[model samples]
Target: MTDFPEIAAANPAFFVERVLSVHHWTDRLFSFTMTRPASFRFRSGEFVMIGLPSEPGGPRPVMRAYSIASPHFAEELEFFSIKVPDGPLTSRLQRIQPGDPILMGRKPTGTLVLDALTPGKRLFLFSTGTGLAPFLSVARDPDAYERYEKVVVVHGVRQVSELAYRDLWTREIFEDELVGEQARRQLVYYPTVTREPFERQGRIPDLMASGKMFADLGLPATGFDPAVDRAMMCGSMAMIKDVAKALEGYGLTEGSNADPGDYVLERAFVG
Candidate 1:
């Protein structure tokens, strides 16, 4: 995607960032980090448009909304993406290497941020596949740890290899100088691979319904207590809807940036 000479040469409305590194997690999933603009400011769990020039000497560009996987406080911006075989962007995007260019949108926005929900004792971040990207950002943000007593992150994937950023959550974050110890103590990661053999192997919705996820975590016997738990969900619209309906059943209400409440969600993809 960055091979285009014209795209790399221009930087008017958008920012062209240099790719720092790229790691292929699986044939279908990968993650990349790029230099961040000093002037760019965004909340931890927000997303921005990113893509390549449309074509040779074309005026328009190929773009898609991508969640910023790195925490806002970090110097670099990271993104987790799926390599759809026929996706207009990912088809070519999957070939990107370090030192290439990436076009980033000017404005970053989303409803999955911590600000969209009210204060609470526990924070639950539920996601699936690449949907886990935003929660990765939220997990690294020092504010998330400071705001809530416990931060529970659940990531569901088809295979164990798809559980991205495993080391960051298990090792690096805790060893970090700024929020390491606090993050280690406050963050609880529960990763599930639905199609693979693992200690935990069920979709989050099923885990919630069966009270098995809560039991594993030693949560209250009745499950969610909206009075103390606030949550954020990201994934396919179907997954989000199912999780949203479940949260509502637990006495939680949907919230937004304008009106903070018990829970909030964002569509992983449009219908």
Candidate 2:
């Protein structure tokens, strides 16, 4: 018998995916991969609803929006989660193991996707905390590299330990046979920490304001040309606001699926 009755499997609108693996990054953070339903499809930077059954015999389940962390080409789906104590969904989500069932929403949608941004020479993906989840998908997608000459990633976290997927991004993805040439010449990684001491430490906005981030990347501090630099921001409401404000000074407009523009903004978390 299954650990829990697969109500989602019976429902045509949902897919009950089996857990493939889980990795713990810290007490408060973790990531897991699950089998992807053959019929399920989504863009690289979209968010989908996920959850465990409300109860063993309960028909309802508690679900929350989570960004799909893996690339669009991957056969399996992956997610980075914040392991909150007693959180309505994550409290139970953190314990999932191989063979466990997890419900996935049929439609994955979000504004952080590349479809919302206008064509440009450089693509800047800014994220913080669990917000890095969606960009993980974007960064790995070969389409992103083909669309722009350069892809700059800026991920901010509290400490060095919270930096997830550094090795994966630097080694595996960047050095992939298909995209290695462009990734080596175009992928610029700028990771920073706010509370802990590290080589680069500061709020992303602060670093951007001080020109240090651009200097480190060997790009001109004033080279944030609205005509060439297209950006996407995923993080807390405050972080998004701060970033949008900075980008607006350069005349970049916020974009949507309906109308592509110079920049795109989306909240990594709600409430």
Using Cα atoms with residue i matched to residue i, what is each candidate's TM-score against the true structure?
A: 0.95, 0.95
lDDT (tens digit, per residue) of candidate 2 on 135-202: 99998888889999999889999989999888876787667876677788888888899999998999
Off by over 4 Å in 1: 1-11
- Each model's lDDT comes to 0.88, 0.86
lDDT of 1: 0.88
The C-alpha local distance difference test score for the whole of candidate 2 amounts to: 0.86
Instruction: Tell how far residue 81 is off in model 1, in angstroms.
Output: 0.7
Model number with the top lDDT: 1
- lDDT tens digits, residue span 69-152, model 1: 988998999999999999989998898899988899999999989889899999999988899999989988889988999999
Q: Enumerate clash totals for all models, in the order shown.
A: 0, 0
